[model samples]
Target: MMRSIDYGNLMHRAMRGLIIEVLRQVEEGGLPGEHHFFITFDTRHPDAALADWLKQRYPEEMTVVMQHWFDNLHVDDEGFAVTLNFGDQPEPLYIPFDAIRTFVDPSVEFGLRFEAPADDDEDEEEDDDGGDDDPAPSSDRQDAEIVRLDRWRK
Candidate 1:
């Protein structure tokens, strides 16, 4: 068979691109209508930048709301930077797109949760797959841990 397209990775890129585009629009003219965003990202990402206090507070993943008040909203190819009020004290943050786990707009009830990239251990296991069979799908049990976007939508 010809080289199979890595749709999973492709989808991840597309989703991140969608976020970049949306943010760029907001950066230019502000959020339209009732739109806002809740972005969750890995604070541990190598390139993630935030106040050390914030990192100490949220050692793992952190979620930020982009509604109401935010300042200096700037977005580029890699990610975005914004200043948010944290307990009445403004703090600056720079989150890389690849570090984002979820991006949601509650007003529209739209949400997306990214899958964690596969590990080398899983790859080694797949090498023993029996011949004459299609390659198994790349996924993990954690992939099933989805964030329900909305109950009323369905």
Candidate 2:
């Protein structure tokens, strides 16, 4: 029997906190060694912000890479914002924690997938992840071992 303690939610909080910590570190000292990230998030999330073109291009979801050239990476308790170059145009975006679908670091072959509850209740503030099941794979993840959190989510 599942306990009422809601360990799942706790774990989710921990995982999201982990991302915040990492980003904080990066914000302070910059990314270490070959450690870059592939963050896939829901474009339609209420708090997510992006350019009109980007939103239209990725109406459902979008993935961004943090590598050689990225700037203004600000991370707080709720989410993060960054400026990334797209075809020579620097685009800024804000991604909330719940909006993330997947977070992957191909260089270390580390990954995390966040999913909403099995029941589809879009109105619940604490019971949903902004995105769907469709994966947003990074080009570099082709050779890495991806970890999934699907079973635990169920």
C-alpha RMSD for every candidate: 10.0, 9.7
Q: Model 2: per-residue lDDT, tens digit, 39-142? A: 88878777899999999877777888899889999998889999999999999999988787678887766787665554244343221333444444332112
Cα lDDT of model 1 by residue, 1-154, tens digit: 9599767666777777788999999999998899988787777777789999888777766788898899999998888999999999999999988777678887888887774644223222211112112222233222312345652244
Q: Which residue pairs clash within candidate 1?
A: none
Q: What is candidate 2's local distance difference test score?
A: 0.73
Q: Per-residue lDDT for 132 in model 1?
A: 15
Q: Which stretches of candidate 2 lie over 4 Å from their true place?
A: 1-3, 119-154
Query: What are the runs in model 1 whose C-alpha is more than 4 Å off?
Result: 118-147, 151-154
Model 1, position 71: C-alpha lDDT score: 99
Residue 57, model 2, lDDT = 78
